[model samples]
Target chain A: MVQLGRRYGTGPSSLAEIALDEDLPRAYLEQLVTSLRDAGLVVSTRGAHGGYELGAPPSEIRMSDVLRALEGPIAPMICATDDPAHLLGCDRSARCTVNVLWVRVRDAISGTLDSMTLADLVPARNITLDPRDPTASPAGVA
Target chain B: MVQLGRRYGTGPSSLAEIALDEDLPRAYLEQLVTSLRDAGLVVSTRGAHGGYELGAPPSEIRMSDVLRALEGPIAPMICATDDPAHLLGCDRSARCTVNVLWVRVRDAISGTLDSMTLADLVPARNITLDPRDPTASPAGVA
Candidate 1:
């Protein structure tokens, strides 16, 4: 996804190019892109120069949506799901105070996920730090 | 753990009792409790009336520690682990902005987990709500 984000405006990138750039198997990339396409996170073009591109700009794509598209609904436990469709509530919820704990946890996870976008992870938007210095912090970090 | 917390200071409760109360198999609960015991969250007594009990007050035990004990370290991704012993960092960390994203997510989860304790989940400390009413909120909820 990051790789795709980097090449967002360049044009549709072939799976072979992505695989080679990311040092992963082209077959694996193909499988992932299929789900991304189905989720409308990416769009595909067909022709001689056919390939895939982001469905929206990187800055507009929430990481939460990306993760959900790839991994299905966010669920920390079977009983605690963020999806309204699955909110039948757990059978033990009546007597289960633990349900609230998982709900809080799921909210924390979802909130964090919602707070960032693909742009936050794209190198162009991140403050570049000296790779060799683990303690180094950029003065201009915003 | 909640069972032991409820039974705290009362006396140790055997796994058989916990199994029946929680409607879980004794064998499964035994495995989970073993991890808890090794983490010093619970203590076991041996003899005719031997069983297990919380090692400390429920309020004193962080849910983060409980979860870490039952599971492993708090790691949203292999690149963003809380444990210093395993801080080799991913090879891609040098150029990977995604690391920070995972770190933020891990912190969100850990912060929420740390904010809660076992007492927060135990029924004795929770405001009892009407079991039949999903929308019902107790006036004394805190």
Candidate 2:
């Protein structure tokens, strides 16, 4: 996804190119792109010179939706899910006072995922780092 | 942890009792308790009424430490672990701009986990929740 985000608007790149650039197996990319395409996160153009591109601009693609498309739903436990419709039954629900904690965890994960887009991960842009970002390591600076 | 938290001041709970209360297999709890005990998250007793208890008060036990003890370091990707000591090798480390996003995610998860303790999950006591907690649902009101 990050590879595709970087190549956005530059024209579709073949899986072989992405695989080589990202050091991932082309076979894995083949399987992954299918899911991403099915989820409308990527668009495939078929032909001799055609391949895959981001379905939308990087900035418009929320990581939450991309993750849900790839991984189903973000859940810390079977009893707690971000999706209201897909919550699994837990025998402890009736007496599980800790369910709220798992729910809070799920919400936190969902909120973080929602706050990011593919553009945030694509290195091609001059991203202004948030001063409060703990991930903004001094190592990342020249 | 929640089970032990609930029984904090009540001495100890036999694995059988806790297995029944949480609907978990006693054998799994047996193994899990050993790991928690080694992490100083739980203490064990031996005798007819012996079982496990929290090593410290519930409020003193951070979920982040508990999770780290149980699950090792938190990382959204192999290259972006929360702990600096245990970063996994990644072929793309040199150009993995997406690594920072995973670090942000780890930080978010750690922050949320650290903000909570077993006390927050133990319903035996009153907890004044923040108004901004999205997981504080109306269903939890009654």
Candidate 3:
């Protein structure tokens, strides 16, 4: 979804094309697209030449959005989750020292992923980077 | 597996105890424990009072170690991963523009998790924050 959001923002794409190009299964991609569509992250057209596309702009799509759509929460620990009110069989939060660390890790992961938008993935301009030269790095040029 | 590692690290715990405490099924946990034991993260002891415990101390374990023992690499994008190479369909090193970003994110997550030892999770000797204050944030503590 993030890739599509960046690539063809508000444009349509055939499921088969994306699957073939991405080397993913068509059936699985189809189901994934359906879920994305339901999440309002994307829209799909059903007629001939119809396909899937982002419903929002690339700048509006965060990695967290895509991740939550696909994999629920990014939490590494259940006790460190946001929905602590619904905790089941685990009332040991008061003494759970590890919970604090997990919370930090969770927040850090969330913050980093949320900070990155789809637009970040698809920069407005082209760039160049030297891989072989240890000190050489990519420098953007118009 | 980190949770399991910490739990078992404290002491050998029965399957029923792990299930009740972790909110996971005994059958599923059995499979997970088997995998961990095979990976040397855990060791099993048999008999009426026997169960499983961490093979090593909390100080010796890293989150990455536990993660690799349970799941696999922590890369958000397959191409960003180090251990398993070229998993992502796109070759960012040679062509893709956004590959560096993925690599950076992957490294950041891994570095943070890997730097903290399991001992860091064991409750601190000196309580930095007031246990009574729900909103109290720890100060001068890492």
Candidate topping TM-score: 1
lDDT of 2 by residue, A1-142 (tens): 9989878888989998999988889999899889899999999999888999999999999999999888887998888987778888786688878677778888888888999999888775443378666665533366
Report fnat in order of the candidates.
0.84, 0.77, 0.45
lDDT tens readout by residue for model 1, A1-142: 8888988888988888888877789998888888989999999998878899999999999999999888878888878898878776767777677988888989999999999999888776434376676655533455
The Cα local distance difference test for each model comes to 0.86, 0.84, 0.70
| Top-DockQ structure, candidate number | 1
Poorest lDDT segment (10 consecutive residues) of candidate 2 chain A: A133-142
Greater-TM-score candidate between 1 and 2 = 1
Determine which window of 10 residues in candidate 3 chain B has minimal summed lDDT: B133-142
Position B30, candidate 1: lDDT = 91
* Window of ten residues with lowest summed lDDT in model 2 chain B: B133-142
Candidate 1 wrongly placed segments (more than 4 Å): A87-91, A125-142, B125-142
How well does candidate 2 score on lDDT at residue A4?
A: 90
Model 1 scores a TM of 0.85
lDDT tens digits by residue: candidate 1, B73-125: 99988888889777667776676778888899899989999999998888754
- TM-scores for chain A over all candidates: 0.82, 0.83, 0.75
For model 3, residues A12-93, the per-residue Cα lDDT tens digits are 7888877776667899998777777777888888899888888888788786777667776677677766445633434666
Docking class of 2: medium
Best lDDT goes to which candidate? 1
Winner of 1 and 3 under DockQ: 1
Positional deviation of B19 in candidate 1, in angstroms? 0.9
